[model samples]
Target: MTVFDDLVGQAQATAVLSRAAAAGAEAVAGGRGAGMTHAWLFTGPPGSGREEAARAFAAALLCPDGGCGHCDQCHQVMIGSHPDLEAVRPQGLSYSVKQTRELILRAAGAPTQGRWRVILFEDADRATESAANALLKAIEEPPPRTVWLLCSPSPDDLMITIRSRCRVVTLATPSTEAVAHVLATRDSVPHDMARFAARASQGHISRARRLALDEGVRRRREAVLAIPPSLTGVGECVSAAERLVKTAEEEAGVATAALNETETSELRKIYGEGSSGKGLNRGLVRGGAGALKELEDRQKSRATRIKRDSLDEALLELVAYYRDVLAMQFGASVELANDDHRFELDRLAQSSTPEETLRRIDTIMRCRERLEANVNPQIAVEAMMLGLRRP
Candidate 1:
């Protein structure tokens, strides 16, 4: 086993990172090195595993035996528990300046145990302008033993000045075969189910795993897929829109509920309610209430973002269904993402013309744009469902 095992289908990137890790080890050993840099930018489309690659590189850099995957160092890095590695994943709409400044302040310190102190930021493109500026200072004058790993959807998503300071790693979307192989091998999913999930997810590794392992996820996806073909009239379109929004809300709640409770409990302990603190100090209680309020606000915003993302996933699933229909209509030999639903795809293809399929695809895309722009989700989705009706 190797550190790059989990980074499926990214051979070029794995090789680049492996060489860089070796150079980092040599650098610490007082030898000449190659392909070692203080900062790295990993760019890829969603589900391409940019953050996964960064974590593997961190493990390799920290492991004494050059990233022996079974070592404690590698395990710690993989689970994000290593003392020398800090991973920042923004929970809300953006990474605020305050949080970035705090991270920068912590990053100025030297490594505690590992050869290098690694700061990994997933979705670095979500950093606010002021936060990005704060991060820029750290990259410009990083500590000798500090490394920064930034992940984004594309190089262009980041400020040019910041991108210029970092070595770039690009990852391609993995093929359906690669995704299915990983699902079957790593998650122990049945071969046929793994193949179905892989095709449905369109190379999204996490979604593929979830779709393979979770019946509810598959059911939700089936519902989304059914909506396109069921939009026979105004009432059905409106009902489908409501169902989609409600399902998204439920999904978002499920995602955040446990996390919210854990955070609240931690805060309570910090504020003197639990054994971690002395019997409630009045002044501390007042401060704690303010902190709790701020946390709740962040949680609300996070919940909203989660709902939007869930809705978008369903929208994309509908889009893929039509894409497959169009592919069938044109006799395209390319792999279909919804191959598990070939019967439905055939029915849709036979029922609708290519122009209708293309128009419906456009409607779904527009709904996505509308959601991103903060338009009412129900309104946009209702219109999209109506537009998807057979003409």
Candidate 2:
């Protein structure tokens, strides 16, 4: 199948990209746009497949057969192995100046394929000011036959100067039905299960897919959604807060440990044995120390991001729980994401008024804001739990 097949529920976006590719092809044929300046900005919500769209566009631009799915160029662009397509995804919280400089240098060179040279800056919002400025210069006056694609959540998330230099392509979140249909058709999942996952994910495709495929992800979601009904007292509220923190810690540990092992192995390869703790090799020792410090810094950033991401997911599940309670209170026949816990939701609906559920949702939203403001995740979640426990 075509690379565009991976993008779910973005028909409008697909159309826009397809038109651009067709225009680029026409330009090449007329010799007026023989060497097209390939620069684009793809903006959309999380899990909206912004990067997937970019990859498809890149494949279409490079494929002489007009993105014929079986072509070598299309396959390489889709898998990120194309000789002329460079994708820069930040490893940590933000792209560094060093990385930006490297990318700029790479962009300055001519393409080996004698076609368009494409550079995709994924999550461009994560670039530091210096990195952004460095990239801005390249975009302002890119080399011939060079194209730059920047992906972010929104245009406002990027510097206006950089945003102005590229063409903007916006993607909307797909409807639940659309997402469910894609999962059923593409992933071969059962229809009911796909619909449940799609509704629970709130239009996030990757999360919906994970919820459909992974038992652990579904279990974690069920646990999070079950918390509101269990909060009968201070003890229970505290217990819920503790459980959330432990889960965040466990998930963060998994991410950091794997990252740490890779960094340690790379460092060891760079510095031979007997390089630690002595006057044996001063340069190697200093280099090793610096590398380890950099790794630790990145690991800390990753841990923070993982914790925030986990809490965000938990918040979404909590919102769904309250929504189900609201639906029950209104005597609505709409399906619930947590249908398996209908008994608990019924109890919640009976004990808490509709206003109470709305307020609880507000509290969760505030906690999300607090976490985004760099507050400690544990404190934010605890405060939310206590608020949710209120009468």
Taking the tens digit of each residue's C-alpha lDDT, what string does model 1 give over 1-391? 8999889899999999988999999999988767799999999978999999999999999999778899899999999899999999988878899999999988888899949999999989989999999999999999988999999989999999999999999999999999999999888999999999988899999999999999999999888888866788899999999999999999889989999999988887778875444555653667987998989989997998899989989988888888899999999998898887899899989987999889989999999999878898889988888888843
Candidates' C-alpha lDDT: 0.90, 0.83
Question: Which candidate achieves the best TM-score against the true structure?
Answer: 1
lDDT of 2 by residue, 1-391 (tens): 6667667788787777777777777765666653234678999988788888888888888888667778899989888999999988876667888889998998888878766788988988989999999888888889977889899999998999999888898988877898899899889989999998888887789999999999999899878977886888888888899899899889888878877888777766666545554542664566867766877787788777787778788888888888988999999999786777789999889988999889988999999899888887778888999999983
Work out the TM-score per prediction.
0.94, 0.89
Q: Please report the candidate that would top lDDT against the real structure.
A: 1
**Runs in model 2 with CA error above 4 Å?**
28-30, 33-37, 274-280, 327-336
lDDT of 2 at 50: 88
